[model samples]
Target: MNIKLSVVDQSPVHGSHAKIEAPRLTVELAQLCDSLGYHRFWVAEHHDSVHFANPCPEIMVASIASVTERIRVGSGGVMLSHYSPLKVAECFKMMATLHPDRIDLGVGRAPGGTGLTSHALAFPHEPHHGDLYAHQAQMLEGFVNGTLPADSPYSTIKVLPDSSPKPQLWMLGSSGGSAGLAGHLGYNLALARFIDPDNCNPAIFDSYAEAWKKAGHTGEPNRMLAIACICAETEEEAKLRAGTAVYRKLAAQMGQREDFLTPEQVQDRYKAMSTSEQAFYDHILKGYTVGTPDQCWQEIESLAYQFYCDEVSTVTVTHSHHDRMDSYRLLAKHL
Candidate 1:
């Protein structure tokens, strides 16, 4: 089975690093991946997150697309529920005009930040917040094709400076509901396995594909799965560096999603965990790829087959930028 590899730069800010360094690091990673010939490099969107630094992925996409060649650069994705589709359409369409086939507009259903931020993003129009993503997606589709029902209010709107080869549209989701929607819309689906692996079951893939087939989508199903990895020269070294990810999962289990803890910081926390808690963390770790290059390759290949993935995107975070780059380099060698 052939599998394509991609990267998701979460822009994680280690306890010792400045938040400002995240964008620079992301750019460097994108350029490095371009040289390495990764299929795509995606920038994540986050707002007011203590660990992550990126607030706007489109700007990062523009920057990465400008600096790199061949590799597709996009939002891992834009949170549609929070923004105007017309504006998002304009921004990405203009980007597509410049970059042509290199642009991807991957829209997500998540809030992208704190609840307060989500509310603020829905300001001046709060009632529609519940069903906003569905509406946002519909308008985005209309604007992209330069078509909406003539009777619809938004039919008059047109994304300015349109060009051929508009940005490829994709749906980013972590749950069955969102996956089903992606299938319904006939958009390329990218599932976030790194978010909640236990819940991201094979059935979810079946669910998405079923919906896609039911929707009569004759085009090829563009399925990409995102998985976290901590590839190193040795399995022992990789596991040691993966403490941050383990702790991040532990924090998620504890209802705190902030990933400010480093491997050193997490050592005490990990020690303090009960045997059951440690076991739980280990189970989550097993879902992730944390080993040498060969090990990582095997894990990725297994996941690609499991999910029937045409492409697999990796999310890797380590304390040092150099080590992280080296991890990607080694993995790319195997791919």
Candidate 2:
């Protein structure tokens, strides 16, 4: 199986130290990833979350595209429920015009924020539907294909220049519903293995492939799996760094959103946790691909072969940005 490395530029702020360098550190890491031969670099859209720095994925994509030459740049995904389909089409068209062959547009149905934050960003009176995502996706395709009515508000307004070929589009999902829809529609799939650890059975990918074939899509479907990957020189050090990530996830799951914790703080918190809490954290971490470089490569290869994936995107969170970059560098060498 072929393996590729990619990063989601969430710019995690893990503690007091991260706050001091998060801004410049994130950009530096992006450059490092580009130079390290990673296949793609994407950012997540988030708001009102102290742990995540990127709220506007479009702006972030522009910044990264400006600095990199070969690496593909795009959103890990844009939350479609929060914006108009026409606006999204125009925004990505602008990105495509700038970067030409190096742009990708990944769309997700989730709001990527809490209820209050979602309301703040969405249209005040816009109607919400149970199948809003599917509808928006169809509208986006129409806008891209220039099939909208000529007299309508969005008809005459073509995305400017339109020089670059339409950007490669992908559907992002953590569940089978979106996977099935993406396959039926013949679009690429970005499976969120990191988010829905409990439900990440190999059958999910099998279902996607079967649906793709049944839908008469003759081309091979491009399936990219996103996983939490942390590789270090030694297993002990990797585990220590992973502990910090575990602590942050636990805090979020427990509804305790506050300042980020340092490695020491994370260790202390883990020690003080009840046995049940520790067990829960351990269970979640088990699904993650973390360990020494050799071990990581094996796990990644196994998953890719089992799922018949075309690519693997690694999402890493280390206490130091340098460590995170180093992890990618190591993975790239093997790839």
Candidate 3:
């Protein structure tokens, strides 16, 4: 089937050396994906999280964009709730000015961290009182596109280095809650299926398209689906590599934060989990698209068709950097 393949890297902390290795590995993977003909390479933002390393995706986008020649580089999502919309617009606009047509500003509503980190981010300023995410998103879009209403408070202030080919704006969501809002704002939607695999709803895409048309958008409303995928030449090897991610996800669900373990170590820990924990682990395991190349492709194809999306972005994490790279390489080769 015809589809555009992309990548969303969380720069997952895999082994003991992740503190120094993970971020660098992201650039390396971007180079690989670019050469492999992947469409875009997006980095994620996190805060005070042991599982992910990079907290500032804007910087990573700059770094990745400088090194890769072809692949689009962007923030898989910036946690918009933590910063001023104007600041975000400035950062991404600067990146776009440097690398026109190659940067994407995908923003999400989540805090990207714990309650404590959220407080840290909002320190000195009282936490926002209401549902201001949508409002912030609107302001962000306005600032980037230079289209804020004339009556708006910030309309007189211009985003400097104004230039053509602004970074593509996207609303990243794990659920359908923001689909319509994204469309109404004329922004693309990127559904993060990896975050909540079982919650897939076709109505989300329908609502987005319907809203886009209602909003008088001229072209097709662009959308993408991001999936947690791990592919290998053999299914057994793929499942073995996925063991670490399964254990880590379940551990986080249970409120425990720890570094990734080996597949063998993960198996030992799995054997000790209680019945409920094991069931939860099983559910987590099922959420991932794990198998040989053809098997992974089949599931991805079906999911894209179901969601009415033509672009598929994969997020792969494994204990070994080579394994992680191989997973993406194999999937790209399959296509």
- Top lDDT prediction, candidate number: 3
List where candidate 1 sits over 4 angstroms from the true fold: 127-130, 255-259
User: Whole-model Cα lDDT per candidate?
Assistant: 0.83, 0.79, 0.89
Error of 3 at 246 (Å): 1.3
Single out the weakest 10-residue window by summed lDDT for candidate 3: 122-131
For model 3, how does the per-residue alpha-carbon lDDT over 1-335 read when each residue is reduced to its tens digit? 58999999999887846477889988989999999999999999999887788999999999999998988899989998888999999999999999988999999988888877877888987666326999999999999998999999899887885545589999998889889889999999999989988886777889889999999989887799999998998999998899988888877877888888998898888899899888988888799999999999999899988988899999998888889999988888766
Query: Candidate 2: what lDDT?
Result: 0.79
The reply for model 2, stretches above 4 Å from the true place, is: 14-23, 126-131, 147-157, 161-164
Task: Order candidates by lDDT, high to low.
Answer: 3, 1, 2
Candidate 1's displacement at residue 31, Å, is 0.5
Give the candidate number with the greatest TM-score.
3
Instruction: Please write out the lDDT profile of model 2 over residues 196-245, one tens digit for every residue.
Output: 87787678777888888988979887788899988889887787778777
What's the TM-score of every candidate structure? 0.94, 0.92, 0.97
Model 3 scores a TM of 0.97
